[model samples]
Structures are given as structure tokens and as C-alpha cells.
Target chain A: MKNTRIRVLIAKPGLDGHDRGAKVIARALRDAGMEVIYTGLRQTPEQIVESAIQEDVNVIGLSILSGAHMYLFPKIIKLLKDKKVTDILVIAGGIIPPEDIAELKKMGIKEIFTPGTDTKEIVEFIKTNVNTI
Target chain B: MDYQEKKRIEEAKKQWENRILNKVLPQFPERKEKFVTGSNQEVNRLYDPLDLEDFDYLADLSFPGDYPYTRGVQPTMYRGKLWTMRQYAGFGDAEESNKRYKYLLKNGQTGLSIAFDLPTQIGYDSDHPMSHGEVGKVGVAIDTLQDMEILFDGIPLDKVSTSMTINAPAAILLAMYIAVAEKQGISKTELNGTIQNDILKEYVARGTYIFPPLPSMRLITDIFDYCSQELPKWNTISISGYHIREAGATAIQEIAFTLANGIAYVDAAVKKGLDLDKFAPRLSFFFNAHNDLFEEIAKFRAARRLWAKIMKERFGAKDPKSMMLRFHTQTAGCTLTAQQPDNNIVRVAIQALAAVLGGTQSLHTNSRDEALSLPSQESVRIALRTQQIIAYESGITETVDPMAGSYYLEKMTKDMEKAAMDYIIQIDKLGGAPKAIEKGFIQREIQNSAYQYQKDIEDKKRIIVGVNQFRSEEEPMKDLLKVNPEIEKRQVRKLDEVKKKRKEKEVQEKLKLLREIASSEQNIMPPILDCVRSYATLGEICDQLRAVFGEYKESIKI
Candidate 1:
């Protein structure tokens, strides 16, 4: 009861096939004693939101490297909202430009990790940022 | 003379080691007891003539343009003509990407390299929900021949060589290209370019794969056979290791896995009763130019020599061109760091230099800001200039295989080649690359390597300047090229308009015909081209094939 494993669903939402970061984060989370479900590349926002809900994941991490985060993240957030799952923590990573970071945060992505992000820092952020419903 | 020279080399090495032990080693301890190459091949502190004791000039390092082209595939190399500086450019809708392509060509880019959006790459119309937000995001969106026509609007298909970095849906894209060329009054025979038609890497490294392996290989062989007769000028497949390396393969693994995939393609074509010489001669390769200078140069040289041997010995191909391993190099995208983004320019310059020194046939230098977002036009221009400056300014291009006879380079080349061949042999034992991929062997190997590399960086074993070391506080890169948010809407509207205008009956007939031939023992190209001519969308054509081949579910555990 004291050390419940946190469940995380990681999905790549968009066209970019660069998944080294996502896989690394998945490994880091799993190594941190969390359950990580890595749905491999090219998942639609609908598929990701559905997967997150199906897996009952506490954290949904989406990696988009193709500069589609502006179009993609908000869509994912909207779908999550439509599903009435507001308590689930949604964090996004990949090549999101500095100016767009604020825009992404405004769309309800709890945290956005940029390049050179330490996985430990991400784990810490997730541990602290998970919604306490 | 050999014995005396070897003795002298050994004595000189001993003296150097003695000095290092006394002065340098005592003052500064070595970084490790043993140093390994990126491939984990153990390396000696000093390489000398003794290391190349059995190295035969003709047998090993053949003259350029000769058998086992260790020196280079081209005799003059860059001297006769500089390697085609094909900057891989595409982002947003076809119109925007077209402007970029024309700008690149006008600014001295020798050819066009089209990067299709996700849906385009994986065989989906822009209107599909699976394609939402991704249409024209990473690359140009092409749902029909209409988009292809717009993409190459004024660009002559016959004159300018184009490379499409789309796999899985390569055949569909190729069909569209041929259709577009036909509309331009260009015959298929006169067109020249490459389709990164190598789909095996899609399953192994890149995750854009759609169909299963057997069908994918069939599609690749279809292109090989079709291009031999129809598009004689076209280089059929750019068997690629660029994605493999970016996916975190070591230099040796990249070479091994890529050439392994090449071997699989060759075998597949041969099994289909296609003459190896006819198709193998057109087989080109795409490699990644990573930050390791010596390793990358060695990788290129070794890949050429090994491929030549594989063709000549394994496949028994007599045509000299069939044995040659001509490759295009793109500077490693994985090495680019968003932190201190300006530093990526230097990183790309070094990697591009390695590719040039390694004797690339064509090269694409990545933009520095690419690690952050789609490169701003300024970043793309600078990326192009990096290639130009290297060609015009770097004196290294003055000589062929400038690093050919380096004691270190020669040893590393042989070592890398040997290690790669060992992996190939292991894969061969596992029933080849496809089987190896199915067994999750190659993917697991890459994942392990990727994990090790990341751990190395995190543990301070490797220093990535901007990220792990030499830390600096800087404002994030701003004004980065962002994809027009409304691109998906525009693309979907265009897709809808095309669908609405096209004859529904004809589209259905073509799609049905495609479904039939896709499962049968016939070349799927003609039917696919028919689908293209009928203005059947990429998703429709692929949907037909998907119904037969079934989508491949990745078995990779990680």
C-alpha cells in the first residue's frame, strides 16, 4: 500500500518517427518502478486519448518531434476534455519552440519538456505534477 | 624492407608509449584502461604499420573506380564534380514546400529531396483522422497526384533528380511521381531520382511501417523490377542507415543492419527471378554522418568495400556497377542539441566534413534548429551554406580519399567492416534481416545501444557539449519555423475537392484491381500506377493493399 506503482501511458502523437526520447523516458519511468505502456509511433490523438483512458494511466506523455505540437497537443487536450478525464496529467515533449511553450501550457498540457531534458527531472516532475483527484 | 620497417615502427611506438607513460600518463591518467570505438570495437592507443602488416594494396584498398572500391566508388570522387548537395527540405503543404524546393534549387541545391508528411509516409489521405494535425507537419502532404504536381510545379522532372524519403508507401509515392512526370511531358525513362524505397528499415528502426515484412519486401522488389524496365534512369532504393543511426545504432550496427537489409532486398529480387546486375546496379544507399569523424569516414569506406565484396562474392554479380556501394549522407540529426542551438552548426559542419572525406555521392546537412523545431528559412539556408562552404572552401576535397592511408583510419575501417560482417553473418544465421527484425533481434540491439548511449551521456561517460557539459543559460530558439496551424484543414479541403472531382467508379475499379493484384503473384506497380492515374488517393490505394497484406503490429517489446 505504501509503494503503489504509478501507471503511465506514453504515446507518440503525430508523424515524426523519432522515438529515442520516448523510449528513454519509458525506460526511465519503468526503472523508477512505474508501469509504462509505450504505444509505438504514429498514434492519432483519438487513439492516444482512448489508450490513456483504457489503460487507466495517471500520466499521459506524448512526444511530437515534427513541429506539430501547436496543432496536436491542443487536439489531444480537447479529446481528453471531451472524455471528461480532467484529472489525468498530460505532459508533452519534443522539439516545441520557446514561444509555443506558453501556448501549449495554456492548452492544459501540465508540463512541457524541451531538449536536453533529464529523465530523472521528468520523473520528478511527473511524481509532483500528477493530479490528486 | 617490411621486417625492418615493422621493427622501426614498433620501436617508435615504444618510445612514444614510454614518453606518454613518464610524462603524460603520470600527469594525466588515461580516460580508461581500454578505449572502444562507437561500435564497441576495442582500439589500440597507437596504430602503426604493424597493424597493417598483411594489408595488400590491390586486394584490400583497391584503386578508386575499381573492384572493391575502398578508395571510393567514383574515380575522381568530388574532383570531377562535387557530390550533389541535395538538402532534404519539406514542411507544411505542397505549395509551401514547393517554394522551399525552388528556393533550394535556385540557391544551388543540385536536387530535390521531398519529405512527405506522416499520413503520406504511412499511406493515409490527409482527411483521415489518423492524419489530423500531422498533415504537412514534418514534411509536405501529398494525398493525390495533384499534390505531387503542385510539389514539382515548375521543377523539371527530367532534369532535376528528386529523392523522396517515404517508405512503406514508397510505391504509391513513386507511382505519383511517375504520374506527375507524365503530366510534365517527361518520360519515365528520362526521370532520375531515388525513393527511400527501403521499407525494411521502417520496421527495424523507423516506426512508420504499415504492412507486414513479406509484403513490404515484395513491394521493394516490385520497385526494383519496375524501375529496371520503366524508370531506367532512376536509382531504385536508397537502402538507408540514416534512420538506424538516428534511432541510436552505433556506426558498425548502422553499417551491418543497413547492408543486411540491402542483402535482403537483393535476395528478394533474385528470388523474384530478376537479374541482380540489372537491379543491383541501380541500388543506392543512404548513410548517417555522425559526429565521430574517423568512425564515420571509416564507416563509409568500409561500407563500400564490404558491399562490393558482398555483391561480387555472395551474389556473384559481374557488373562492376552492381558491386559498387554509392551512398548519400545526411549529417546526424540525433547529434543536434536544442541547448545552445548555435553549437549544432559546428556539429553539423564536422559531420558533413566526415561525409565528404568519406566520399559521399550526395549529402544532406541538417539545420541546427531542427532539434528545436522545423527550421526557419534562415536555418535551412545556413544548413545549405554549410555544404557549399565545405565543397568550395575546404581544401580536403582537393584529393581523393584524403584519409585513405592513415594508420588509424585504415585500421578502424577494417575493424568496422569486420564487426559489421560479423553481425551480418549472425543475422544471416537468424534467417536474414526480416527474420531478425521479427525475432526483435535488430530492434533489441538498437534499443540496447540507444539505452547505453543515453546512459553514457547521463553518467558523464560521453559529453554532449550543449546538453551534458559546458552548460550555458540561453534564451530558447525563437521564431523557429512553425507549421501553419491551418495546414491540416487546407490539406483536408484539397483532399476532399480531389475526391469529389475524381470519378468514383474508376477509383473503385482501380482500388479493387489493386486489392486483387496485391495478393496475387503479379507486379503491384502497374495496378498502383493505375490507381494513381485514376486519382485514387494514397490511403485508398494502400487500403486496398492493407486489406490483403494486413497491417504489421510491431513486436518490439520496448
Candidate 2:
């Protein structure tokens, strides 16, 4: 199976309401010609994983500002593993502290974009990392 | 000034633009072809009397406490007793938040602003499955009346005012607060505080909403009807644009959306047959003070004037107090940068000054390290001291509306008022705020602005001091306040104990009564207060309302 455009799912996986960054990134991704589907605020880990699998997205970008990234991010990664899904790249962005980034990446998150990241960097990251076939 | 004088100034301005400005532009090119404010509103090279040809002093800019309160709300403004220095602080468990409250009060903070955790804000108990990994993370977790009591432990409700930043489950939290106050021997009439009971913003910007619009408005009006009789001094609703702005609205959109929501609330209350004067006076506002010095200041003045006219002409309320839009301002949190966190202190100080110059009634200054985590104790101390320095040392507070008569300021204020009023008219045409929200109009507008803002920053059109322009190598932020992960286990354990020890039968009865009252035409406050008094958890009561009112699922739009 081959894909024409990079499909990405931008999901907010916690109860936090700070979606400015997520919405901005989703649009930026779309502007960069990626097919982006945004799961609106307060999506559970199961919901996000299911959506990513169903949408056949090459990447899953989880945005959280609620400091629950330590617990939520790992649960999401494990869910992906248990579901026998291996093709998706999981990335995250928000008000994540620096010390927690290493652990999150070790849990299978490819990269974590903190506050003040340029959208071009994220677009470039997705284009460079995701393979079409 | 007369028309001839204005014409003369216009001619002179054109002459200067051709002679001096054009000559300098060719020799030393301007930094940018055009300059704009944070909202992208164009800024002229200079403002003059020509900008005010249509301005009417008596009708537009009146004295403090008069109709169209564009200058200042109070006659003496900060010269009389200064604005309340409040800081929004809460994290971890109840006891921890209580300690923070006492520490802030001891350090010359005049008021308290409680930040509830996500579960508490969204009407979930600490033990609920939805609250997993979220308990006591962002704010103090309060599951029931017991937790509320401990959170406010020794602080007398009569002495200091408290503002709870909770919506959707605001009625339940207000019930808990009143119950705690009753335990402290304080009467409801003597207590003064505010609840961020503006649910429209929740649907529009903040996503903590529970029920649909009709039922949500019912709950709000129920509070209005109940409070006018019992809690006379308490501010019934803090119609907020603070979250709207932080969620990436322009300054003009912030004013327009907030007042549009305010209008919707008033219309709902009036439809419920509530008295306008009684409930309207208790209505306060909350706004965000961002980095644009003159624009933010002008926004405050314009919002005050526009709201006064709305209440007077549109709603036809006769009480002068009903028209005064007293607001609490917080320094914009989104403007803070994580790259160089210490620079946030200067940003906050400038914002706090803008709030003062713009005639804010009360203010909460964001800490230096808030962009990374919850503000550290030392960072919060510095934030509070920023307000203190502006109050005592800065001589600006010595006068009322010191920036009032400047040509640039006056024109900018008028422009803001007109632009915001145009937005209100647009919202009204689309039915109202709630309808506009349901149609995703407000959300789309904010998202566009947010995307545009990011684009500007990335393109270097907008220079965010530490973020976009200045390059800095910084170490990881230290002394950052981290909520202990053990706090979640402790909170869940306490909630479980409360559920087990409480009289389950009484809890059911009270919740049953609440459902009946919510479905009926009566005020739902008394039954909700009963549910709180009986030790029923917040989630339990909201579950009943969920059954009756149903939850609101927003129409998602990118």
C-alpha cells in the first residue's frame, strides 16, 4: 500500500482547554499540504489511538498543556503497542517541562515540541520523518 | 476644536507627510512598510487633532462614574485605596493550597483567586475514571464540601474576597463555598467574591463546559435569582474575555466576544423574569492585559464605554451601577515565554502598569516561571511585588486616567470601541453568543487569529522579545513548582473515604431533589446547596444534572 500525501492526526488527549497551540499546528500542517484531522478537546487515550488507526495517519501529534503528559502520553503509547499498530509516529507539544521530555521520548514519543516552536519546524519534521510507502 | 482648526491640522499633517516623512523615508528607510498592533489593526505614523474630528467629549468621554465610563470607573480611581493585588495560585491538594493562600495574604495580597484542577472544573470527582492522571495537577482538587473546607481553612470569608476560576460546575462550587462560609459563622450576605460563571466563554474558548446552552443558562439565571436575595454583596457572574484572549483572540475580539456573551447572559436572565437592576449590578468582568501598551490600555477604556452603552441603551437599565463594567485584569499568560523565563517579570510589570492605566478594578499578575509550570513561591512573590511596586512607587496611580487626553490614545480608544461594537452587531445578527458558538463562528474567528499570530511570529513580522527575535541559551528552569504525583493518590483516597463514610441515602435524596428542581421552573441553588451540605461529591450532583440537562458536545471546526 502506498500513500500520496502525509496524513496526520492532531489530538488533544487531556482535560486541559488550552488548544491554541494545537489548533495553530493543525492549520499549519494543513497549510503545508498534509491531510490533518483534529480530535477536539478532551479526547481519551483510547479515542486518540482509535482515531489515528482509523484515519490511517502516518503521524499522531498529541497536544497537552495539563502537565498530565507523564501519565497520559505513556498510556497512549502503550495503547498503540497493544493494538498491534506500529507504523504511526507519535509526537507531542505543549507546556511540558524539560526534565520530563527524555522520559516521554523513551516511552516512544518521537519528539516533543515545547512552547515557542515554529510551525515550519513541525511541518519539516513530519515531512522528513514519515515515509509515503 | 472647531472644523477649521481640524482642517488646518489635516493640511499640516499632509504637508509633514510629504516634506519631512517622505524625505526621511528615502534616506533612512523605515523598519517596516507598515506598523500594526497586536490585533493587526494598523497604526498611523502619528495621531493628531484630525483623528478626533468626529469625537464628542461629553457623549464619548465622560467623567469617572458617569455614563459611558471611558475615562475611569471610579471618581478617584487608584488614588482611593488602590486596586486589589490578587494572585491566582493553587496546586496539589487542599492543605497545600490552603498554605499558599495564607502565605499570599501574609505577603500583602489583598485577595485570593482559587485555581481548581481539571476534574473539579469539568464536574468530575477525584476518583472518577476520567480524572485519572489529572487529579490535583493544574490546581487544587476539591471533590466535595470537605475538601472545600480544608482549602479555605483559616481564611475568613468575611475578611478577604475570593475568586474561583471555575465554570460549567460553577453552581456546585459556589454551593461548596457558601457551605464553607456558613461553617465559619459567616453569612452569605457578608461574603464578597466572584465565580467565573461565564459558561458562554467555556463553549467558545475554554472547553470546561458540561451541559448544553439552554440548561447552562438556566443554571446561571438560577444563581442570579438566588443571589439577589441572599448574597447581595457577592458578584454573581464574572463575564470573562481573559480566557478568550489567552485562547488567541485579538484585543478587539476579546472585547466583542466577552460583551457579546455578557449580552446573552443578560437576555437569558431577563427572559427568566429576573430584575435587570438587581442582578446587573452584581455582574463583573474579567479581561487579559497583553503586551501592547497603548492598545491594551485603549481596549480597557473602550470595553468600559461599550458595555455601559449596551446596558443603558440596549437593555434599558436605569441603575448607574448596572452600567459600570468593573473588571479584574490578569497579565496575559500566553505572552510569557519559556526560552528566557526571567524576562517574564518585566513583561508582567509592563502589563500590570497597562492594567492600572486602563483603570482595572482588581488584578492578578502572572509569575515569572508560569510558562513552564505552576509558579514557584519565589516567582509568585516577585509577581505580587510587581503589582506592589506599581501601586506605591509608580506615581501613575496618583491620578485618574492619566493617559486619557493623548491624541494617539483617544483615537485608538475610539477605534477600538467602534471595531468591537461592530463585532457585537455581527454576533447579534447571528442570533447571539451561544448560537454563534454552536455554529462555530467564534471558534473559527479565534483560530484564524491564532494561526495568523503564529505565522507572524514564525515569519519574524511580530517580534516576541525573547522568543522570536533575541537568541538566548538558557538552562532548564529551576525552583519550578511541581505538583506531587502522590497528591493524586491522596486526593482519590480522600474522595473514596468521603463516599464511604457519608450517608449514601441522604446524598441520593439531595441529588434527587436537585434533579427535580433543575427540571422544574424553580431556582436550583437551594437543592444544590443541600447536596453540598450532605457531603455529596461534585461528580454525583453533576451526574444528575447530566441526566436532566445533557452534556454539550461542541461542533469541531479546524
Candidate 3:
């Protein structure tokens, strides 16, 4: 079985149907020779967590634009904790405000990427931070 | 000029090109080998009469308010009445948003366009766990008829035209609007507004859909028949290109895909045995006015002409109003930059000018602070004043189709129409908009364009004044409007109060009737009105229908 490439999952976890950034990152990650999975719009946290566990992805990236990250991100983090999927590096990107970044980081998010962040930076961050199995 | 004069000019041009230009071109080489528009339309360095030597004025460029309206729709246009100054505003709770609406009206807004939060847009009440932190975040949280009543508390139904930006549950929101009007002692016939019931675009661009495609069409056609019979003044569907453009479709794809969706909606209605002439006049459009000024203006002109031909040639409708493509234009939100907040005001002003020059029937200028969050009060006021300044001060509104005879504009308009027509033909070959969307054709085109646009920005080939090429150090922005977090808790408590107080039996009976109507072929609007009047929550009504018409799960191939 093949197991060398870093597996990353990019998903939109809210009701806002903004998939441009999510799809961009998914393409970028795939171009970087990583296995990337994209869960389309309006996915609940439960669906995201279940997909993550089934795919056994190394990293999970969320793209939230609807300003519900305070509730949604933490809920996903708690679900991962309950499921004991702590090895997965979690990151976020979107229209997140500057004030919420620290709180999101404190909730076990490895990083917060806001608008204007380059996708090359995202690919590098995953390569360095996430431990490849 | 005469043929002799033209020959001399051409000979002079050839001599200059050979002698001076050829030598100078090597020393100062052209920056790039090719130039293109946002939609990948090739652009020449210059345009002249030779570009449109075969242009037809009477056949191709008809007068305003005539058949095949390549110009503006109305005869007198802004001279008779200025385009409606509608600033789309709604945030926090209903009472808070109501205050904003009143403030906007006081500031000379001619119409009200409500923006609902994601939960309300997707047909959920405030207390649902899915709506926990999103109750009133992006837009106002609308749960029950009570919330809607509070939204238009002091606004009279007969006085102002309202547009609600809701798609999946557009039928429910329309019922709530009519129910609120009834309480205000206004008849359904007196109510004038529009519901954005275009669902095909949801599958194409956004994801605010509840039911799947077939049942969603049923909901839309039910509104078409019901509103045609009862609320005669209401616009049934606003087939929108705004979201499609925002999702990064080029101007040509925006026109083609949106019109393709319009064709599908009309086909669905006609198949249901509805008269095209009766409902086609009320089928308005919404388009995005982006940064490319002349291109956007040409796009609007092209859209009107294309739709006019579609109505007359395809649908064979006889009513003049049926053929005219009346539309609302919103300044593009994707063009705004978070780098410099105040620069957005200037961007909005330019885009608004394009829409005005393009003869949009209505316009919304987005606020400067929208890229960060909901705009502050001052920011919104400035945005409204942007529209006001264009309508009152800008002399561009005096003459209709001022850019009509310009060689550049006419050629570009024809080119955009041709390109968009090609796309419509392709989608038509694939069985229409719905089947094309199911196959991800439209979505993939938008995604590819979006990727190219982003790549251009990152590579600095396309210069965003604040974002890509020119960035500077700045202090962090302050006083940006943040929705109060406690609004969620209070909204949930209010939803609980309604669920506890409303007559449970009446709500159940109405919901059951809605279920039966949804399951069968009967129109779903009357039972929906009964449910809303009985104080059934938005979630309860949508849930009852969702059980019959299952929720839509997209095929994610990205």
C-alpha cells in the first residue's frame, strides 16, 4: 500500500457557499503532490469528523466565511478530541477576524490563515508541521 | 470621410507604422505580446470605425424601449424616473435590522432589500443547533412571521418595493410578507415586492438549497402561479447573475449561464401549463457591476438584447413588458479589498457609475467595510450616498445609451453576446441548465476562471490597487461592526417562547396540510401561508417539506 504523501482534507464547514478559496487550496495541495480531499458546502461538523476518520487524513483544513468559527471550529475540535484524532494537524482560512485567531489557536488549531495568504505558504506549513506516517 | 480621404489616412497609417512605429517598437518593446479582458476577450490597442464598418443601426441597435432592446429598456429611462436606490441591508435581529431599514429610507433609499442570515436562508429557526452561533451573524435572523412583522414594522406594504434575497425557502418568505401585509390592513393585491426564487443558480454558484432540483422547481412554479393569481404586482423570480459573477465566472459565462438558468425556469413554467406572457414580464434579473467599466456597461446592454430575442423568438411572447429585461445591479463584492478599507468606496463608486451608464433599473453599492464584517452605520450611509451622487450629480444619466455609437462599446457588446450565445448553445446541447449543473459543467467553468483570476493576482499580472501591486503599512481597522453574540441566546429564547405560545394543534394541522400539498401536484403557497399565519416556525414548515422532498446533497468533484 502507498502511504508516503501527506493527506489533507479541505472543507467548507458552514452555510455560506464560498468554495473558491477551498477549491483553490485543494488544487494547490494536490499540485504539491499531497493527497487532498474536498468536502463541499454546508457540511456539519459531524460529517467532517466522520470523513476525516474514514479517510485517515494527516491534516484537516477548514474554510469558514460565515462568522460562526467560534462555535463551529471548537465543536469540531471537541469531536476530534472525543474521537482521539489528535495527531491530525488542524488549520483554518477565510474571512476570520484578527481577534478570533488567538482563541482558535488556543482551541488546538495549529494555525489560522486569513485572506491574502498565499497557498504556497499553506502547502509549506503542512509539510513542516504535520508528521507524515 | 470620403474614399479618397480614407485611402490617404490608411496610406499615412502604413507609412507611420513602417517607419516610426517599427523602429520605436524595438527600442521600447511592447510590455506583453497579448492583451485580454477579464473574460479572456482579446483586446486591440486601438479601435476605430473600421472595427465596426458593417454596423447596422436600425436592425442591430434598436432604439430604447423597442424590440430587441440593445439599448436601455425604458423609453425615457432615468429622465422619467431614477433607478431605485436599494441598499441591501439587514443584520442582527429583526428589530435592529428594522431600525437600519428605517435609517436607510430616511437617507433617501427608494427600496428595501433584506439580507437573511444563513440559517434563515437555509430554512432553519434560530434555536436549532445548526444555527447556534449563526443566528444573526451575516444577516438578520428570520424565524417566524413575528420576526418578519418586526422587520417591516413601520414600512407600509403599498409605499415601498421590497426584495428579499432568499432562494430555497423563497415561498415561505413570500407568504410571510403577504401575511405581514394582511396584518397591516393591506390586500395581497396591494403588496409589491420580489422573492429571489431562482434555485438553479444555487446549484450553480451558492449552496443555500434545501430540497433537490425537481421539487425545488415545483416550489418555484407554485409561487409563479400563486403570485400571478393573488399578488399580481409581485416579481416571481429574480434570475440572478450576481452570485455567478461573484463565484468568478467571467462576464460572458455570467450572461450565458444565468440566461441558461432563466431559460430552464421559463421552460419549467411553460411545461406546467403556465402562460409565458403573464409571468415573463415579472421575471427580472440581477447582475454584478464589476471593475471593468466599459465591459460591464456593454454586458448590461448585451443581456437586455439577448433576453429580448429569447422571449420573442424562443417563447413567442407578445407582451412588450415580457421582452424587456429589467434588472437590478449590485457593485461586485469580490472586487473589494481588505488591504485598504476606504479604497472600496472609490471602487464602489466606479462600479455604480458603470451600472448607471449601463441603465440598470435598480442598484446597490456595497459598503467599504464589508470585506471585514458587516459594515458600520457610517460605512453604509456612505455607500448609499454613492448611489445618490450618481443619480443626482452625474450628468451621465441625462442621455440614454450614451455609449451606443462608440466603436469600442458596440463591438464589445456584440462580441460578449456572441460568446455568451455560444455557451448557451453548449448548455442547451447538454439538455439544459439543470443537467449541465448536475454534470458540473457550469461549476467547473467558474472554478477554472476563479483559479485563473487568483493566479493573476498572485503573479501581479492583474494589479489590485491595494492587494497585489501596491501595499503599504497601516494601522489595524477599528470600530468595525460586530454582531452581538448575545443576540443568539436572546433569539433562541424568543424562538422557544413562540414554540411554547403558538397553538400547537393549528401548527400541526397546517404543517400536515403543507406536507400533503408538497407531496402532491397542488400549489404549495396557500398551505405555506396557513402555516406561517398559524405561527409555525420556519424550521417546522421546511422540515415537513424536507421529509417529502429530500435534502439536496451535491456531487463534490473538486
Candidate 4:
């Protein structure tokens, strides 16, 4: 019944506990009339991918500030591809250096949002790119 | 001035606002409809004598080192001795961080503050599957006492005062430190240092928790008992508001929540039949210094005065040292911007100056390139030099609280105290900090404030120098410090070697004893020390406790 609205999973995909930006974006997405499921701190990439598939969410927004994006983001994307769950729009935000964004995008992360990104931009990106499966 | 003179000034100020100001307002107006502090508290255009008509100087702010300690903790303040210049630095493997420590100490740094990596902080060995990408990422990785020994290889424990920023595994790390000191042929009594053992903020903000709150508090009280008996100079717990502020708490919430947690620790220790005066003197605090110069200064002053009163009135402490709220301050990391990263140096300088003006006991100025990556050697050197410049070159340290009697500062300090106290009263009604955090009251409040802060920035209500205003195109920063992925492989391999070299029989026996002590009502510190002395890994010891005290499952609320 809620299929008309976009569903998003705001996941904290690493050991980093800096969740202020993640929570803010979650609330903003919720206020923008989307359903947001926030996976709290210390979640592994496997848990994130499983939740994305289980919830049938339209997007998986990964947030990590612990400098583990180079290792963790690829694993999550690989897991989604292995499961053939390609419809989920993958995005990330945190302390990602600019040098890593190209490889991350090539690995299937749709976009990489760094620090100081406005939440409105994230919301618009998700709404425009969400693929209804 | 008398009451009549005060009345005349008040009337003249009102007339000036209405008559002269009204005429000029038609052509030009204020930049914003209202100005607010960093915490969103409204700031008036000006503060004068009219604001402090009922202010009592003697009772409210006694002399330095006197009751209430509103002026400063020491009698002469920085005139007697400059504050300790401690830079918090750690990354990569133990060898890498050891070199950084030696580098810092050689460059006029007075103290060492250790930062542990995520795996070390969350009680996982570097080889643990969950710690694959995280080893030696955020901070240094320590798998066993061997790693700790390598961390302080040449550093003399008796000479240098160290502060370890570890919480969930604090006792294990502290025990390793003690073992390292013993190996150095130094007595435990001579070791002067502190451990960030405060765990309440973990549930609210930092989230490096392993055991649940009940068992975690017991471990904290055990450390209190052990340190008071053995290491008298070692500060047991540094009740911290630094992470809470960085997690988007307003300044008022920062002090209120931090002090509330402090009260809870005291209550737990007293409930365990410990003397308040014995541990209270060693109970230090840690706070953040943000860009709001006057507000941050007032926050520190109000925090000190409020803690003094809380000890005297609430806890009935008799020792003057027990009542003093000694604290360490770090310039706010959350305030730094990634764009035009060099501008962060000026931001750090202003924040550092505010900490000095507010009477911080020790200070850490953040590096300029931190917002982009881990600071390079050059950036950290500049950060340490920033503190040195304030201590030796700036004459502000020559006086004790030079901004003490300013009308605006006094009124703001008083108002901050009242507001923060109101928050404490609310937390008390919810049965103190742990209960408040359990019910998700504190987290929700911080989240709301955090969301509002982000909204303000996005809406252009707040102007960040290089982020939202005065924009400029810049090239990518060069020489950013990157932790080598090879460090992880090398660390895990070393951990394996240590595991093979240690006596397995003694490790099992010590871990067994630790489990027995943890399950029983006895203090767990002694057994933990035995485990560390036996070269039991951090993960091995924490896993034993996790078997007894279940891991904390965070209730997700966003």
C-alpha cells in the first residue's frame, strides 16, 4: 500500500559513530514524504545490503566518517550486485576524500556526497534517481 | 552607580533606541532580524550595567582557588604555570604512532593524548573479521600488551603525563599501561595520567560501547576503587562533553548533560561505599571550545561554577580540591570546514584563544587539514605551535580571567548557568543521565539541535567563512595523511605472532579468573591486569565479558 512513496534505508555502514549528518538526512528525507529506515551504529556492509533487500527499499544511503569507505562501500555494492538487487539507488556521505569518488562510482555507488552537502540536494538526488522496482 | 543613575541610563538607552535608532532604521537595518549564539540562544545588541543591577560579586564569583571557583581554579592561574599543551594524535600501527609521539614530545608538547582505532576502541582484535577495514584507521591499533609496549617504546611513563581516549575497553588499556610501566622499572604510584573511562556519553553520542550500562558502570566504579588505592596521581575518569558537543549538542546541553553524567558517576561510586573526597579530586572534565568566542568562554566559566556548587551543595564534599572542576579543552572539530581547509587554522586560533580566556587547565588546538583528512606532520606542528603562541607570546595568560568583570560576559555566564541548571533539573526528574539516555530523551534533544543546526546552514541563516560565504575555487589539498592498508595486514600478522609466543595456559587461567571476577561482586581490575600481564588480547578479554555482560544493542531512532 505504501509502494507509491519512495523507501530509503539510511545506513551507518562502519564503526564510525558520527551519525549527526546521517540522522539529519534521514529526518529531512522523512519530511520530504519518504519512508526512511535508519540502521544504527556499527553495522557491517552485509547487514546493510541484507536490510536493503529485505525492506525492498528504493535507495540505500551509506554514511561513514571513519575513512573505511574505500574498503566498505565496494563490499556493499558487490553484495547488492551478487544478490541481483540493482534497482536500489546507492549513495554515500561522510569524510570521503575526492580521490576515491571516481572508483566508488565505478563500483556502482550512484553518487558520493561529502561533508557540507545540503540535505535538500540529497533528497532531490534520491527522488530523481529512484528506480521503482 | 546608584539606583537613580542606573534608572537614568536605562531610560536614555530606551530613548536612543526608539528616537535615534528609529530614524536610521528607515534607511538601514540590522543584517539579520536577530542575532543568536552558537547554541541558538538570542543575543541582545548590547549589554550594560542595567543587566547586572542585582548581580552580587562576592557570593557569585569569589577569588581564584576559593569557594565556587568562578574566576579560575588556581590562585595565580596561568601566571603560576602555563596550561599543558597536549595534542591528541594517533593513527596507523603502533610503530607509526610511536614515532608521532616522539615527534610531538620533541617539539615542545608537554603531554600525550592517545587516540585508539575503531577496532581497539570497540574491543576487537586487529584480526577480527569485523575489524577488516578499520584497523589502524582512526587511531593506533593495540592488540595486546606487546602493542601497548611498542606504543610507548621509548617514552618514559614516570616522566610524561598521558591521557588515553579509550572508553569501552578503558580498564584493559589502563591495565596494559600499568604493565608497561612495571616493565619500565617504574612504580605504579609514579604514573601520572588519565583514562577517558566515562561511558554514558557513548550511548548518547560516541557509540563505542561493548557491555551494557549496568556492567559498564560497575567497571568504572572498580577503576575508581583501584586507582584511589594504588595510583593516587592518575585521574580515573574524565567526564567529557567534547564528543557530545561535536555530535551537535548546544553549549547549554553540553554542560548540562556532561554534569548530569558526572553526578551519576558520583552516585554510583557512593552507592558502592567509596568516599566522595577520595575520587572527586581526580575526577576531571573535558569540554569543546567552539567559534562563538564569548559564548564558549561563558560556557566554560558557568560549567566550572556550577560543578563547584554541585559538589558542595549536593554531594557535601569538604575538600576544596574536591570542589574544583578541573578540565581539558580541545578546539571544536565540528566547526572546521572542508572547503578552503587553510581557513580552519584561523578558526582554531580563535577557539584556542577562547579556551585560554576561559581558564582551561590544558588545551589541544586542532590541525587545519583535519576536516579533509588526518592532519599531516606539518599541520599538527602548526596546531601545537598555536597553543605555544597563546601560552608564551600572548600576554593574556599573564592575568587570571582578564574577561571576568566584563558586563556582557558576566550576564552571559550567569544566564548560561541558569539555563544549563534547568536542563540538569529536567534530567534529574527522569532519574539522572543514564535513565534519561535510556528513555532516549537526551539523544532526541541532541538530534533536534543537530537537525536545526544543519537546517540553518542549508538555509543560509549562518555564514561559514569558506563554506557558505566568500566562496572560492580551490585545488585538491596535497600531502594529506593516509593510513596505509598494509598496516592492517602487518598488525594482524604481529598479533598472530604474539598469540603464538605467549603462554596459552596462563592466558586461559587469567581470562577464567577475569570471568569469575566479572560475574561476582568483586572488583574486576585486578583480574583484568592479570590478563593483560599474561598477554591476553583485547578481544579475548572483552569477549569473556561479553559472554557475561551482554553487548549493548542500540535502539535506532532518527
Q: How many collisions per candidate?
A: 0, 0, 0, 0
lDDT of 2 at B179: 98
Cα lDDT over the full model 3: 0.89
Q: Each model's TM-score, in the order given? A: 0.96, 0.98, 0.96, 0.98
Order of candidate numbers by DockQ, starting with the best? 2, 4, 1, 3
lDDT by candidate, in order shown: 0.89, 0.92, 0.89, 0.93
* DockQ, every prediction: 0.67, 0.82, 0.66, 0.78
Query: What is the C-alpha lDDT profile of model 1 across B127-210, one tens digit per residue?
Result: 887777778888899989999999999998988999999889999999999999899998899998999988889887788888
DockQ of 2: 0.82
Which residue pairs show backbone clashes in model 1? none
For candidate 4, lDDT tens digit of each residue in B432-494?
999999999999999999999999998899888887788899998888988998999999999
TM-score of chain A of each: 0.95, 0.95, 0.95, 0.94
Clash pairs, model 3 backbone: none
Q: After superposition, how far is residue B56 of candidate 1 from its true place, in Å?
A: 1.4
Best by lDDT: 4
Model 4's CAPRI class is: medium
Candidate closer to the true structure by TM-score (higher is better), 1 or 2: 2
Q: Looking at candidate 2, what is the lDDT of residue B459?
A: 94
